[model samples]
Target: MRTTILLLLAVLPLTLMAQRWHITGFGGLSNYQGDLQEKRITTNQANGAFGLGVQYDLNPKLSLRGGLVYGKLSGDDKKNTDSFLVARNLNFTSPLLEGHILAEYRFFDLDNYRFTPYVFAGLGIFGFEPYTFDTTGQKYYLQPLGTEGQGLSIYPDRKPYKRVQVALPFGAGLKFRLNEMVTLGYEIGWRKTFTDYIDDVSTTYVDPAALLAERGPKAVELSYRGGELKDGNPNYPADGTVRGGSKVKDWYYFQGITVGVRLGSGSGPFSGGGGGKRSRQTDCPRNVF
Candidate 1:
């Protein structure tokens, strides 16, 4: 991490010297697509998101940006039309914080055109902790409970997943330059994640007696919530019965407006040292005047 930071510091000045710098801010909504979600994408549980970033226009066609974003995501099986899902009765909410760096390609030049459509792809590292409220309205974090039998000695194959994971972000948007100093745009971006546990429901059911004894009753209660629904099946599934998808991973998306403020001259000599003749004034200028 130290080496990476030093390298970025070394390269930033060079990038700034040759390119236009824009400090950007983002406001948008974020939503997730996971095992509990009824569809791939929807605004049902979308939450507000905010971000701040710095963009460098490398040239007319390419640019680079890095930013930090904060967003909230959630999923609930109760919202689904599928009967099996509604019976699952699982729900979760997580606050996601991410840092990303991306390379953007613009289809048109901003110098001559007022607007341009651009696409971007990048990598990100994000941290999240899924949690939900119990029937008594108490909040319980899902991970440490070993709801899916994770972290239990007997379930050697099921280990606790990391809270911090990586993601691949790619999307397209349109940008409109409002003036010489300000630019406005909107974008919709998707993050393909590596883990299926973002919603805290993955894999098969664990023995209720084992979960109750090892992690306590709350663990078992939150894990299998089917009984909580009205006239819902109260019997717990067998130890190996499927509780959630074991194969498919999860995804999240962000869509919003962006505001950018341009910094420095668009076309100017390098801010860093450049070879140029220095100007000098004549000493006799006062006498001549």
Candidate 2:
């Protein structure tokens, strides 16, 4: 970590000199998709995300950037009519705290327009929290089976799943100089995570009876509200089961598009330097008539 900080610091001056240091922030929308209830569900979800950080110009051709970003992804799921007799709805929301270190290379730099186009790729770390809400308006926490408990939503007493995973962040964007001291840009990127439980859905289906037997009535009701009971007993196989939990290895991904402006010193590749007739004059010098 110290080495990483040092490396960033070492490149700071170069970025500053090249007019590369920028304070950027952005907000955008994203959707969550993948295995839910044994079916692939893609919902039109809305997301908002923003970041604040500085970029270092390694040179006119390359640069590095890092920032702290807070983002959310949410959507709703409907039960599959064919496989399950119960009618239910699942809603989920995940807020992530992410940090990204990216390397950017510019493809075109138009001196006349003061605009640059670039592409970037990097790694990030994210904190994930996933929650489930049932039709009854009650919320139940879920955990991966066998990690600390026996079944899904079984331990109502336990906390939600919190994990730290590595992420791959890649995207492209364009920057336009508003002036020497200001710049504006827009970016679109995708974050690929290592965890499969972003939506609180995975590969295996749960036996409703077995889950209820372990979790009791409160949990069963909370997780399966608004659904018809084809089976009378929680352990009875005849009643439809909750699909998901068989380990198929899944990951959560979110896409972001942002537009923001930066404020900084106007000295760099586009500033044209500080030398002119004004340099020879003191404060408010007047021309002799």
Candidate 3:
């Protein structure tokens, strides 16, 4: 991390010298798509997200940007309109945090053309912890419980998923120059994540008896919410029953407006950018006539 920071600083002068440095801040709604609510773009569960970034334009059409973003993502079958989903009654909310380095390609130059549409793709590392509340409103973190049989010696096929994972972020946006020193943009980005456990509902249901023995009653309660739905028994699905679609992965989205400031030039010639030729001052005596 230290090396990376030093490298960025070293590159800053080069970026600004070329009249291509920009610092930006973005904030807006974020949403998730997974087993809970497949194919829905509705904002019923939207959460807040914000980010700060720096960009270096390599040319009128291409640039490189690095930034950090944070947001909250949640999914609740109880909050879903689908009757079958609401009956499933499973839910989880997790904080989303990541740092990304992306390459952007623009259709035009906002600096000179006034407006531009662009696309970006990048890699990121994100951390998340999924949790939910019990009937008495007691909150429980689901990871250590081995829900869906994760980390259980008996369930050889199910392995524990990590709290931090890799993400692929790609999307498009439009930018408008607010002035020579500032720019405004709006973008919609999607993150394809490797872990399906972001919501802690992947794989099949585990045996209640075994789950209870290993992780306690709290695990059993969280592993299966439908048991208390309308029936006294939670064993209807039995073990190895489908609790979540493991075949499909999970994804999250970020869309928001950005405000950015151009850096360097106005500060001073010694600050970095090309100084060009220093023209000689005119003779003062001639102006007195």
Candidate 4:
């Protein structure tokens, strides 16, 4: 009986320490939805996304997760088979970095099953720099140009948009416990943003004359890029013409596999002779989730 008690005490600390925290690493494809994306999912245009995160299990059913992710989003009118979109001749790419905090809910008690489905929701902010290449292959950042009459004397109603925007991320995933310390997960998350200018295309075209005077001639050239239309003698859109939809906002997505592992600390949950019931449930359960 004394030997069994000693063995239980030794095992208890290890189990609690293992359950406290986990580190996650993930990588996968990313895509965006906006005026440029006629289709919701464009695999050919998918960009790379990667992230590193940490998780703290609050209970058998819930956890708190925090992470930083980097994703690249891009869109081009040229990729569209739609006749009208092809004539638009505009394209932009934005690389984003985001930090988020989320709550994760497991549908089944993790201790009861090796596999579980889960859902997560979080708030985050991301920074993006939208850029496009000119005919000479020189890259230009679009925000400075105020493409839609922003930051211009002629258009006081239009304000310069922010480079960093807020977003809500929500998603679901399925995870499989590979071992006592490691788990694998497949997740797909959508970032619903508050801003529509992630691609630097929104609202109506600004007057070229005004943009040239305020920003530069290059600004005017990039503000309306239909000049390279496949059909000869392309007619550029006039000022006040629709450049992008104003009513709807842009969105981006991430879908990938995550590998997680628990790395314990000396003063963990099960340290200093914690509750025996909690420690026992870590190894043995009377009922399943």
Over 4 Å off, model 3: 1-18, 230-236, 266-289
Residues 107-223, model 1: lDDT tens digits: 865554567899999999999999999998999999999999998888988999999999999999999866555779999999999999999987899999999989999998899
TM-score against native, each model:
0.86, 0.67, 0.84, 0.86
Stretches of candidate 1 exceeding 4 Å from the true structure:
1-19, 265-289
Q: What is the C-alpha lDDT of each candidate?
A: 0.85, 0.56, 0.80, 0.82
Show pairs that collide, candidate 4: none
Whose lDDT is greatest here? 1
Encode model 2's per-residue lDDT on 15-83: one tens digit a residue. Answer: 556455556666665544444433332335557667777777665557788888887766455444433
- For all predictions, the C-alpha RMSD in Å is 10.1, 9.8, 8.9, 4.8
Can you write out model 3's per-residue Cα lDDT over 1-289, one digit (the tens) per residue?
9999999999876755656777879999888898776764657789999999898877767889999999998998867777766767888888889899999999865543567889999999999998989999998888988888887778887888899999999999988866567778899999999988888977788788888887888988887777767754455468877788888789988999988787765422232223432223312321332
lDDT of 4 by residue, 1-289 (tens): 9999999999876677575889999899888998888676667688999999999888767889999999899999889887666677889999989999999999865544677999999899999999999999999999998988889998999999998989999999999876556789899999999998988888998778888889998888887777777663356577888888989999998998988887753323532224423354444532343
- The better-scoring model by TM-score among 2 and 4 is 4
What's the TM for model 2?
A: 0.67
Candidates in descending TM-score order: 4, 1, 3, 2
Residue 159 of model 3 has an lDDT of 84
Q: After superposition, how far is residue 62 of candidate 3 from its true place, in Å?
A: 0.8
Candidate 3: 10-residue stretch with minimal lDDT: 277-286
- The lowest-lDDT stretch of 10 consecutive residues in candidate 4 is 265-274
Question: Which candidate, 3 or 4, would have the higher TM-score against the true structure?
Answer: 4
Candidate 4 displacement at residue 242 in angstroms? 0.9
